[model samples]
Target: MVVVKYLLKFLAVLLLFIEIDCDENDIESRVVDGQLVPIRRFPHVAFLRIVLPYGEENVCGGSIVNQFLLVTAAHCMDFVNLRRDSIWAYVGHENIDEINIIRSVKKKYIHEDYDPFLNTPISDIALLLLKEALPLHKTIQRILINIQFPSSKFVTEGYLAGWGLVDEVNETPTMWLRSITQELLDPRFCYRILNGRIPGTFCGGSKHANRPRPAMGDSGSGLISKHRELLGVMSVKSAKSPSVAFYTNVTSFYSWLVKTAQEALQSTCGHL
Candidate 1:
Protein backbone atom coordinates (compact mmCIF):
# COMPACT_ATOMS: atom_id res chain seq x y z
CA MET A 1 0.00 0.00 0.00
CA VAL A 2 1.13 3.54 -0.72
CA VAL A 3 1.71 5.87 2.23
CA VAL A 4 1.34 9.69 2.29
CA LYS A 5 3.06 11.92 4.83
CA TYR A 6 3.92 15.63 5.12
CA LEU A 7 7.59 16.32 4.41
CA LEU A 8 8.14 18.83 7.22
CA LYS A 9 6.46 21.58 9.19
CA PHE A 10 6.46 25.17 7.91
CA LEU A 11 7.87 26.60 11.11
CA ALA A 12 11.07 24.56 10.91
CA VAL A 13 12.09 26.09 7.61
CA LEU A 14 11.04 29.52 8.81
CA LEU A 15 13.29 29.41 11.87
CA LEU A 16 16.93 30.33 12.21
CA PHE A 17 19.46 28.77 9.83
CA ILE A 18 21.67 25.98 11.18
CA GLU A 19 24.79 24.22 9.95
CA ILE A 20 25.63 20.49 10.01
CA ASP A 21 28.99 18.90 10.86
CA CYS A 22 30.23 15.45 9.94
CA ASP A 23 32.93 13.35 8.28
CA GLU A 24 32.47 12.24 4.64
CA ASN A 25 30.13 9.37 5.51
CA ASP A 26 29.63 9.67 9.23
CA ILE A 27 28.00 13.07 9.00
CA GLU A 28 26.17 14.41 12.04
CA SER A 29 23.11 16.67 11.90
CA ARG A 30 23.63 19.65 14.21
CA VAL A 31 21.60 22.84 14.45
CA VAL A 32 23.84 25.85 14.95
CA ASP A 33 23.41 29.53 14.21
CA GLY A 34 25.97 32.13 12.96
CA GLN A 35 27.89 29.62 10.81
CA LEU A 36 28.08 29.11 7.04
CA VAL A 37 26.93 25.73 5.66
CA PRO A 38 27.91 24.46 2.22
CA ILE A 39 25.39 23.23 -0.37
CA ARG A 40 27.46 20.35 -1.73
CA ARG A 41 25.01 17.64 -0.61
CA PHE A 42 22.52 18.02 -3.45
CA PRO A 43 24.16 19.08 -6.70
CA HIS A 44 20.87 18.98 -8.57
CA VAL A 45 19.16 21.26 -6.08
CA ALA A 46 20.08 24.84 -5.23
CA PHE A 47 19.94 26.13 -1.64
CA LEU A 48 17.97 29.34 -0.97
CA ARG A 49 18.40 31.47 2.17
CA ILE A 50 15.52 33.86 2.92
CA VAL A 51 16.79 36.79 4.94
CA LEU A 52 14.63 39.02 7.12
CA PRO A 53 15.61 41.85 9.46
CA TYR A 54 15.92 39.62 12.54
CA GLY A 55 18.07 37.00 10.79
CA GLU A 56 18.20 34.67 7.82
CA GLU A 57 15.70 31.82 7.56
CA ASN A 58 15.87 28.86 5.21
CA VAL A 59 12.13 29.19 4.98
CA CYS A 60 11.85 28.04 1.37
CA GLY A 61 13.72 26.05 -1.29
CA GLY A 62 13.94 27.31 -4.85
CA SER A 63 15.02 26.25 -8.36
CA ILE A 64 17.28 28.44 -10.51
CA VAL A 65 15.49 30.00 -13.43
CA ASN A 66 17.61 32.32 -15.67
CA GLN A 67 19.72 33.40 -12.71
CA PHE A 68 17.43 36.35 -12.08
CA LEU A 69 14.35 34.53 -10.75
CA LEU A 70 14.16 31.64 -8.30
CA VAL A 71 11.04 29.49 -8.36
CA THR A 72 9.78 28.40 -4.96
CA ALA A 73 6.56 27.47 -3.16
CA ALA A 74 4.10 30.30 -2.47
CA HIS A 75 3.27 29.10 1.05
CA CYS A 76 6.77 30.20 2.03
CA MET A 77 5.21 33.66 2.30
CA ASP A 78 2.97 32.75 5.21
CA PHE A 79 3.68 34.89 8.29
CA VAL A 80 6.30 36.53 6.09
CA ASN A 81 5.95 40.16 5.08
CA LEU A 82 6.15 39.75 1.31
CA ARG A 83 6.60 43.47 0.74
CA ARG A 84 9.22 43.98 3.42
CA ASP A 85 12.76 44.75 2.30
CA SER A 86 13.76 42.34 5.03
CA ILE A 87 13.36 39.59 2.41
CA TRP A 88 16.45 38.61 0.40
CA ALA A 89 17.37 35.54 -1.67
CA TYR A 90 20.87 34.09 -1.95
CA VAL A 91 21.85 31.71 -4.70
CA GLY A 92 25.12 29.89 -5.86
CA HIS A 93 26.29 29.73 -2.28
CA GLU A 94 26.76 26.40 -0.57
CA ASN A 95 28.21 28.07 2.48
CA ILE A 96 26.20 30.94 3.93
CA ASP A 97 29.25 32.45 5.60
CA GLU A 98 31.27 32.97 2.44
CA ILE A 99 28.69 35.23 0.83
CA ASN A 100 29.24 33.61 -2.57
CA ILE A 101 26.47 35.66 -4.22
CA ILE A 102 23.33 37.41 -3.01
CA ARG A 103 20.40 39.14 -4.69
CA SER A 104 17.61 41.30 -3.34
CA VAL A 105 14.05 40.36 -4.14
CA LYS A 106 12.93 42.57 -6.99
CA LYS A 107 9.37 41.47 -6.31
CA LYS A 108 7.27 38.49 -5.18
CA TYR A 109 4.10 37.14 -6.76
CA ILE A 110 1.67 34.63 -5.22
CA HIS A 111 -1.08 32.94 -7.19
CA GLU A 112 -4.50 34.56 -7.11
CA ASP A 113 -6.43 31.40 -6.23
CA TYR A 114 -3.97 30.46 -3.53
CA ASP A 115 -5.95 30.14 -0.31
CA PRO A 116 -3.75 30.37 2.78
CA PHE A 117 -5.61 27.51 4.56
CA LEU A 118 -6.50 24.93 1.97
CA ASN A 119 -5.80 21.23 1.90
CA THR A 120 -3.29 20.15 -0.79
CA PRO A 121 -1.72 23.60 -0.68
CA ILE A 122 -3.60 24.95 -3.67
CA SER A 123 -1.36 26.88 -6.13
CA ASP A 124 1.37 26.82 -3.53
CA ILE A 125 4.17 28.00 -5.80
CA ALA A 126 6.01 31.38 -5.65
CA LEU A 127 8.82 33.16 -7.50
CA LEU A 128 11.69 35.29 -6.17
CA LEU A 129 12.64 38.34 -8.21
CA LEU A 130 16.36 38.94 -8.21
CA LYS A 131 17.93 42.39 -8.42
CA GLU A 132 20.66 41.20 -10.80
CA ALA A 133 20.64 38.56 -13.49
CA LEU A 134 22.76 35.46 -12.83
CA PRO A 135 25.72 34.33 -14.88
CA LEU A 136 25.05 30.92 -16.42
CA HIS A 137 28.67 29.77 -16.44
CA LYS A 138 30.46 29.10 -13.15
CA THR A 139 28.19 29.54 -10.14
CA ILE A 140 24.60 29.21 -11.41
CA GLN A 141 22.34 27.11 -13.64
CA ARG A 142 18.62 26.59 -14.19
CA ILE A 143 16.46 23.46 -13.89
CA LEU A 144 13.18 22.93 -15.70
CA ILE A 145 9.92 22.05 -13.95
CA ASN A 146 7.89 19.85 -16.27
CA ILE A 147 4.38 21.14 -16.92
CA GLN A 148 2.91 17.73 -17.72
CA PHE A 149 2.47 14.31 -16.16
CA PRO A 150 5.89 13.21 -14.91
CA SER A 151 7.33 9.92 -15.95
CA SER A 152 6.84 7.27 -13.29
CA LYS A 153 10.20 5.91 -14.44
CA PHE A 154 12.22 9.11 -13.84
CA VAL A 155 10.37 10.00 -10.64
CA THR A 156 10.38 6.64 -8.85
CA GLU A 157 13.12 6.26 -6.25
CA GLY A 158 14.21 9.88 -6.48
CA TYR A 159 16.53 12.06 -4.36
CA LEU A 160 15.74 15.17 -2.30
CA ALA A 161 17.59 17.53 0.10
CA GLY A 162 16.86 20.62 2.19
CA TRP A 163 17.47 22.39 5.54
CA GLY A 164 14.67 21.15 7.76
CA LEU A 165 14.18 19.50 11.14
CA VAL A 166 15.73 16.41 12.65
CA ASP A 167 12.51 15.66 14.54
CA GLU A 168 8.79 16.39 14.81
CA VAL A 169 6.89 19.71 15.27
CA ASN A 170 8.68 22.45 17.28
CA GLU A 171 11.80 20.32 17.68
CA THR A 172 15.32 21.75 17.61
CA PRO A 173 16.21 22.57 14.00
CA THR A 174 18.74 20.47 12.16
CA MET A 175 22.12 22.17 12.36
CA TRP A 176 23.25 21.28 8.87
CA LEU A 177 21.99 20.11 5.46
CA ARG A 178 19.92 16.87 5.25
CA SER A 179 18.65 14.66 2.44
CA ILE A 180 16.98 11.27 1.64
CA THR A 181 15.73 8.96 -1.10
CA GLN A 182 12.15 7.73 -1.61
CA GLU A 183 9.96 5.73 -3.94
CA LEU A 184 7.40 7.37 -6.23
CA LEU A 185 4.30 5.32 -5.67
CA ASP A 186 1.50 5.14 -8.20
CA PRO A 187 -1.24 7.77 -7.83
CA ARG A 188 -3.77 5.19 -6.71
CA PHE A 189 -1.53 3.91 -3.94
CA CYS A 190 -0.71 7.47 -2.86
CA TYR A 191 -4.42 8.32 -2.54
CA ARG A 192 -4.87 5.39 -0.19
CA ILE A 193 -2.18 6.79 2.09
CA LEU A 194 -3.61 10.32 2.24
CA ASN A 195 -7.04 8.96 3.28
CA GLY A 196 -8.43 10.71 0.20
CA ARG A 197 -6.70 14.02 1.08
CA ILE A 198 -5.08 13.79 -2.33
CA PRO A 199 -4.41 17.18 -3.92
CA GLY A 200 -3.31 15.70 -7.22
CA THR A 201 -0.03 15.43 -5.34
CA PHE A 202 2.92 13.11 -6.03
CA CYS A 203 4.49 10.49 -3.68
CA GLY A 204 8.10 9.38 -3.05
CA GLY A 205 10.05 7.87 -0.13
CA SER A 206 12.70 5.37 0.82
CA LYS A 207 11.83 1.86 -0.29
CA HIS A 208 14.78 0.38 1.55
CA ALA A 209 15.74 0.39 5.20
CA ASN A 210 18.38 3.03 4.49
CA ARG A 211 16.38 5.53 2.45
CA PRO A 212 16.29 9.19 3.56
CA ARG A 213 13.25 10.72 5.25
CA PRO A 214 12.02 14.34 5.40
CA ALA A 215 12.08 15.98 8.82
CA MET A 216 10.03 18.88 10.21
CA GLY A 217 11.95 21.83 8.69
CA ASP A 218 12.31 20.58 5.14
CA SER A 219 9.13 22.18 3.94
CA GLY A 220 9.17 23.85 0.46
CA SER A 221 12.27 21.82 -0.44
CA GLY A 222 12.48 20.27 -3.85
CA LEU A 223 11.94 16.59 -4.70
CA ILE A 224 14.30 16.16 -7.68
CA SER A 225 14.84 13.40 -10.22
CA LYS A 226 18.13 11.77 -11.17
CA HIS A 227 18.45 14.20 -14.08
CA ARG A 228 18.02 17.01 -11.57
CA GLU A 229 14.60 17.97 -12.91
CA LEU A 230 12.18 19.33 -10.33
CA LEU A 231 9.19 17.07 -9.71
CA GLY A 232 7.40 18.51 -6.69
CA VAL A 233 7.59 20.81 -3.68
CA MET A 234 7.51 19.46 -0.12
CA SER A 235 4.32 20.67 1.61
CA VAL A 236 2.74 18.29 4.12
CA LYS A 237 3.33 14.93 5.77
CA SER A 238 1.89 12.84 8.59
CA ALA A 239 3.65 13.91 11.78
CA LYS A 240 3.52 10.31 13.02
CA SER A 241 3.99 8.18 9.89
CA PRO A 242 6.84 10.27 8.58
CA SER A 243 7.54 7.80 5.85
CA VAL A 244 4.42 9.13 4.14
CA ALA A 245 4.95 12.69 2.85
CA PHE A 246 2.84 14.67 0.38
CA TYR A 247 4.26 17.20 -2.11
CA THR A 248 2.72 19.43 -4.75
CA ASN A 249 3.00 17.89 -8.21
CA VAL A 250 4.84 20.40 -10.42
CA THR A 251 3.62 18.79 -13.61
CA SER A 252 -0.01 19.01 -12.56
CA PHE A 253 0.29 22.78 -12.22
CA TYR A 254 1.99 23.34 -15.58
CA SER A 255 -0.80 25.35 -17.12
CA TRP A 256 -0.93 27.83 -14.28
CA LEU A 257 2.85 28.11 -14.20
CA VAL A 258 3.15 29.05 -17.87
CA LYS A 259 0.48 31.67 -17.44
CA THR A 260 2.06 33.03 -14.28
CA ALA A 261 5.52 33.17 -15.76
CA GLN A 262 4.25 35.02 -18.79
CA GLU A 263 2.38 37.51 -16.67
CA ALA A 264 5.39 38.08 -14.41
CA LEU A 265 7.73 38.70 -17.35
CA GLN A 266 5.42 41.14 -19.07
CA SER A 267 4.23 43.99 -16.90
CA THR A 268 4.99 45.99 -13.76
CA CYS A 269 4.82 42.61 -11.98
CA GLY A 270 8.41 41.73 -12.76
CA HIS A 271 8.84 39.99 -9.43
CA LEU A 272 5.40 38.45 -9.09
Candidate 2:
Protein backbone atom coordinates (compact mmCIF):
# COMPACT_ATOMS: atom_id res chain seq x y z
CA MET A 1 0.00 0.00 0.00
CA VAL A 2 1.21 3.55 -0.66
CA VAL A 3 0.61 4.54 2.94
CA VAL A 4 2.63 1.62 4.25
CA LYS A 5 5.38 2.16 1.75
CA TYR A 6 5.84 5.73 2.90
CA LEU A 7 5.48 4.84 6.56
CA LEU A 8 8.46 2.52 6.60
CA LYS A 9 11.19 4.99 5.72
CA PHE A 10 12.35 8.09 7.60
CA LEU A 11 14.11 10.73 5.51
CA ALA A 12 17.85 11.16 6.11
CA VAL A 13 18.23 14.26 3.89
CA LEU A 14 16.61 16.57 6.43
CA LEU A 15 18.99 15.26 9.04
CA LEU A 16 21.94 16.33 6.88
CA PHE A 17 21.09 19.96 7.68
CA ILE A 18 20.92 19.37 11.42
CA GLU A 19 21.83 22.62 13.17
CA ILE A 20 25.41 22.85 14.49
CA ASP A 21 26.83 25.77 16.51
CA CYS A 22 29.57 26.70 14.11
CA ASP A 23 30.65 30.36 14.06
CA GLU A 24 28.26 32.27 11.78
CA ASN A 25 31.17 33.43 9.62
CA ASP A 26 32.12 29.86 8.81
CA ILE A 27 28.76 28.71 7.49
CA GLU A 28 26.43 30.90 5.49
CA SER A 29 22.67 30.36 5.00
CA ARG A 30 22.50 28.37 8.23
CA VAL A 31 19.56 30.81 7.84
CA VAL A 32 22.95 31.49 9.55
CA ASP A 33 24.46 34.41 7.78
CA GLY A 34 21.87 35.04 5.09
CA GLN A 35 20.39 38.51 4.89
CA LEU A 36 17.12 39.19 6.60
CA VAL A 37 14.42 39.12 3.97
CA PRO A 38 11.63 41.56 4.78
CA ILE A 39 8.10 40.23 4.69
CA ARG A 40 7.10 42.54 1.86
CA ARG A 41 9.85 41.50 -0.55
CA PHE A 42 8.68 37.92 -1.07
CA PRO A 43 5.56 37.44 0.97
CA HIS A 44 4.51 34.42 -0.96
CA VAL A 45 7.24 32.34 0.66
CA ALA A 46 5.17 30.29 3.13
CA PHE A 47 6.52 28.93 6.38
CA LEU A 48 5.55 25.29 6.49
CA ARG A 49 6.64 24.41 10.01
CA ILE A 50 5.29 21.40 11.83
CA VAL A 51 5.13 20.24 15.45
CA LEU A 52 4.79 16.53 15.99
CA PRO A 53 2.32 15.17 18.50
CA TYR A 54 5.34 14.07 20.48
CA GLY A 55 6.59 17.70 20.59
CA GLU A 56 9.33 17.57 17.95
CA GLU A 57 9.46 20.58 15.64
CA ASN A 58 10.32 20.77 11.95
CA VAL A 59 10.75 23.74 9.61
CA CYS A 60 10.40 23.62 5.83
CA GLY A 61 9.60 26.19 3.12
CA GLY A 62 7.11 26.57 0.28
CA SER A 63 5.68 29.23 -2.03
CA ILE A 64 2.08 30.18 -2.79
CA VAL A 65 1.48 29.17 -6.40
CA ASN A 66 -2.27 29.78 -6.51
CA GLN A 67 -5.14 30.87 -4.31
CA PHE A 68 -5.32 27.37 -2.86
CA LEU A 69 -1.96 25.81 -3.63
CA LEU A 70 1.64 25.90 -2.46
CA VAL A 71 4.46 23.82 -3.96
CA THR A 72 7.01 22.18 -1.67
CA ALA A 73 9.37 19.20 -1.49
CA ALA A 74 7.86 15.84 -0.81
CA HIS A 75 10.54 15.08 1.76
CA CYS A 76 9.12 17.90 3.88
CA MET A 77 6.17 15.59 4.42
CA ASP A 78 8.77 13.40 6.13
CA PHE A 79 8.25 10.52 3.75
CA VAL A 80 4.66 10.35 5.03
CA ASN A 81 5.90 10.08 8.60
CA LEU A 82 4.32 13.51 9.05
CA ARG A 83 0.62 14.05 8.63
CA ARG A 84 -1.34 16.85 6.98
CA ASP A 85 -3.37 17.56 10.13
CA SER A 86 -0.22 18.25 12.12
CA ILE A 87 1.28 20.51 9.45
CA TRP A 88 0.44 24.22 9.24
CA ALA A 89 1.23 26.77 6.53
CA TYR A 90 1.97 30.37 7.44
CA VAL A 91 1.73 33.32 5.06
CA GLY A 92 2.23 37.11 5.16
CA HIS A 93 4.80 37.17 7.91
CA GLU A 94 8.56 36.95 8.17
CA ASN A 95 8.48 35.45 11.62
CA ILE A 96 6.76 32.13 12.10
CA ASP A 97 5.22 33.11 15.43
CA GLU A 98 3.90 36.37 14.00
CA ILE A 99 2.26 34.92 10.93
CA ASN A 100 -0.66 37.01 9.67
CA ILE A 101 -2.74 34.11 8.43
CA ILE A 102 -2.51 30.35 8.90
CA ARG A 103 -4.27 27.45 7.25
CA SER A 104 -4.53 23.71 7.68
CA VAL A 105 -3.31 21.56 4.82
CA LYS A 106 -6.39 19.83 3.46
CA LYS A 107 -4.42 17.46 1.25
CA LYS A 108 -0.94 16.82 -0.11
CA TYR A 109 -0.02 15.35 -3.52
CA ILE A 110 3.50 13.94 -3.69
CA HIS A 111 4.90 12.69 -6.95
CA GLU A 112 4.11 8.98 -7.27
CA ASP A 113 7.78 8.26 -7.92
CA TYR A 114 9.25 9.72 -4.71
CA ASP A 115 11.52 7.14 -3.04
CA PRO A 116 12.85 8.16 0.33
CA PHE A 117 15.75 5.71 0.36
CA LEU A 118 17.44 6.97 -2.79
CA ASN A 119 20.73 8.85 -2.23
CA THR A 120 19.02 11.81 -3.83
CA PRO A 121 15.27 12.07 -3.97
CA ILE A 122 13.82 12.14 -7.47
CA SER A 123 10.36 13.59 -8.01
CA ASP A 124 10.84 15.18 -4.61
CA ILE A 125 8.12 17.73 -5.36
CA ALA A 126 4.76 17.96 -3.64
CA LEU A 127 1.73 20.26 -3.84
CA LEU A 128 -0.04 21.29 -0.66
CA LEU A 129 -3.77 22.02 -0.86
CA LEU A 130 -4.95 24.60 1.65
CA LYS A 131 -8.19 23.98 3.50
CA GLU A 132 -9.17 27.54 2.65
CA ALA A 133 -8.22 29.82 -0.21
CA LEU A 134 -5.80 32.64 0.47
CA PRO A 135 -6.72 36.28 0.06
CA LEU A 136 -4.17 37.50 -2.49
CA HIS A 137 -3.25 40.98 -1.32
CA LYS A 138 -0.15 43.09 -1.82
CA THR A 139 1.74 41.47 1.04
CA ILE A 140 0.93 37.97 -0.10
CA GLN A 141 0.71 36.78 -3.70
CA ARG A 142 1.42 33.81 -5.95
CA ILE A 143 4.70 32.96 -7.67
CA LEU A 144 4.19 31.65 -11.17
CA ILE A 145 5.68 28.20 -11.76
CA ASN A 146 8.02 27.79 -14.71
CA ILE A 147 6.67 25.30 -17.22
CA GLN A 148 9.30 25.70 -19.89
CA PHE A 149 12.92 24.67 -19.44
CA PRO A 150 15.01 27.79 -18.91
CA SER A 151 17.74 28.01 -21.50
CA SER A 152 21.41 28.46 -20.53
CA LYS A 153 21.19 32.14 -21.48
CA PHE A 154 18.01 32.58 -19.44
CA VAL A 155 19.47 31.13 -16.24
CA THR A 156 20.22 33.81 -13.73
CA GLU A 157 21.60 34.07 -10.23
CA GLY A 158 19.06 32.24 -8.06
CA TYR A 159 17.75 33.42 -4.73
CA LEU A 160 16.30 31.25 -1.96
CA ALA A 161 14.70 32.04 1.40
CA GLY A 162 13.62 30.00 4.38
CA TRP A 163 13.36 29.69 8.20
CA GLY A 164 15.63 26.70 8.56
CA LEU A 165 18.01 26.18 11.48
CA VAL A 166 20.43 29.05 11.95
CA ASP A 167 22.97 27.37 14.18
CA GLU A 168 23.91 23.87 13.15
CA VAL A 169 24.40 22.75 16.75
CA ASN A 170 21.43 24.43 18.39
CA GLU A 171 18.55 22.61 16.72
CA THR A 172 16.60 25.87 16.65
CA PRO A 173 15.42 27.80 13.62
CA THR A 174 16.53 31.32 12.78
CA MET A 175 14.74 34.15 14.57
CA TRP A 176 13.68 35.77 11.31
CA LEU A 177 13.39 34.89 7.63
CA ARG A 178 16.61 34.89 5.60
CA SER A 179 17.55 35.06 1.92
CA ILE A 180 20.69 34.26 -0.08
CA THR A 181 21.74 34.48 -3.67
CA GLN A 182 23.22 31.25 -5.12
CA GLU A 183 24.80 30.25 -8.39
CA LEU A 184 23.11 27.52 -10.39
CA LEU A 185 25.64 24.85 -11.30
CA ASP A 186 25.29 22.21 -13.94
CA PRO A 187 23.06 19.45 -12.55
CA ARG A 188 24.41 16.61 -14.65
CA PHE A 189 27.01 15.85 -11.97
CA CYS A 190 24.29 15.79 -9.33
CA TYR A 191 22.43 13.17 -11.34
CA ARG A 192 25.48 10.95 -11.15
CA ILE A 193 25.87 11.38 -7.38
CA LEU A 194 22.15 10.98 -6.77
CA ASN A 195 22.36 7.64 -8.66
CA GLY A 196 19.34 8.59 -10.70
CA ARG A 197 18.16 11.86 -12.16
CA ILE A 198 14.46 12.22 -11.98
CA PRO A 199 12.85 14.48 -14.53
CA GLY A 200 12.28 18.10 -13.44
CA THR A 201 15.25 18.31 -11.09
CA PHE A 202 18.24 20.67 -11.08
CA CYS A 203 21.08 21.85 -8.77
CA GLY A 204 22.45 25.10 -7.24
CA GLY A 205 25.02 26.34 -4.70
CA SER A 206 27.32 29.24 -3.77
CA LYS A 207 31.05 29.55 -4.45
CA HIS A 208 31.75 32.47 -2.12
CA ALA A 209 32.02 30.46 1.07
CA ASN A 210 32.48 26.88 2.13
CA ARG A 211 30.82 25.49 5.23
CA PRO A 212 27.21 24.38 5.18
CA ARG A 213 25.24 23.53 2.05
CA PRO A 214 21.86 25.03 1.08
CA ALA A 215 18.63 23.59 2.55
CA MET A 216 15.13 25.12 2.65
CA GLY A 217 13.74 23.10 5.51
CA ASP A 218 12.00 19.77 5.25
CA SER A 219 9.44 19.33 2.44
CA GLY A 220 9.68 22.51 0.38
CA SER A 221 11.41 25.78 -0.36
CA GLY A 222 11.20 27.67 -3.62
CA LEU A 223 14.31 28.55 -5.69
CA ILE A 224 13.86 31.58 -7.96
CA SER A 225 16.26 32.24 -10.79
CA LYS A 226 17.83 35.63 -11.55
CA HIS A 227 14.86 36.41 -13.75
CA ARG A 228 12.59 35.68 -10.77
CA GLU A 229 11.09 32.68 -12.52
CA LEU A 230 10.17 29.80 -10.24
CA LEU A 231 12.88 27.17 -10.76
CA GLY A 232 11.70 24.45 -8.40
CA VAL A 233 11.70 23.30 -4.79
CA MET A 234 14.94 22.83 -2.81
CA SER A 235 15.16 19.10 -2.08
CA VAL A 236 18.49 17.50 -1.08
CA LYS A 237 21.83 18.69 0.34
CA SER A 238 25.40 17.47 0.85
CA ALA A 239 27.37 18.45 3.95
CA LYS A 240 30.52 19.31 2.01
CA SER A 241 31.36 22.95 1.45
CA PRO A 242 30.47 24.44 -1.92
CA SER A 243 28.10 21.51 -2.20
CA VAL A 244 25.38 20.99 -4.75
CA ALA A 245 21.77 21.72 -3.73
CA PHE A 246 19.45 19.47 -5.73
CA TYR A 247 16.10 20.95 -6.63
CA THR A 248 13.08 19.43 -8.31
CA ASN A 249 12.83 21.19 -11.65
CA VAL A 250 9.57 23.11 -12.04
CA THR A 251 9.37 22.60 -15.80
CA SER A 252 9.52 18.81 -15.53
CA PHE A 253 6.39 18.67 -13.45
CA TYR A 254 4.51 21.79 -14.52
CA SER A 255 1.73 19.85 -16.18
CA TRP A 256 1.35 17.52 -13.22
CA LEU A 257 1.28 20.46 -10.87
CA VAL A 258 -1.48 22.19 -12.81
CA LYS A 259 -3.62 19.09 -13.18
CA THR A 260 -3.31 17.88 -9.59
CA ALA A 261 -3.54 21.26 -7.91
CA GLN A 262 -6.50 22.41 -9.98
CA GLU A 263 -8.31 19.12 -9.49
CA ALA A 264 -7.64 19.04 -5.78
CA LEU A 265 -9.02 22.55 -5.42
CA GLN A 266 -12.16 21.64 -7.34
CA SER A 267 -12.93 18.45 -5.40
CA THR A 268 -14.19 18.01 -1.88
CA CYS A 269 -12.10 16.40 0.90
CA GLY A 270 -12.68 12.74 -0.01
CA HIS A 271 -12.38 12.86 -3.78
CA LEU A 272 -8.62 12.33 -4.37
The segments of candidate 2 whose C-alpha lies over 4 angstroms from its true place after superposition are 1-30, 79-85, 191-198, 207-213, 216-219, 240-242, 268-272
Q: How would you encode candidate 2's per-residue C-alpha lDDT over 6-104 as one tens digit per residue? A: 434312211111111123321102354567888787766888866676577677888887666788888777644444237788988887778869987
Over 4 Å off, model 1: 1-46, 51-58, 167-176, 206-211, 268-272
Estimate the lDDT of model 1: 0.56
For each predicted model, how many residue pairs clash, with residues at least 3 apart or on different chains?
Answer: 25, 12
lDDT digits (tens) for residues 1-272 of candidate 1: 12222224312321111111122321101111212334643533445556555665645566665445566777776656756534555555454455456666767777676778875666777766665555554445566565455566544666666655555435666435556766776667666666674554776663332335675555667777777667887766654444656677777766666565555445422232
Candidate 1 all-Cα RMSD: 12.1
- Report model 2's TM-score to 2 decimal places: 0.79
Highest-scoring model, lDDT = 2
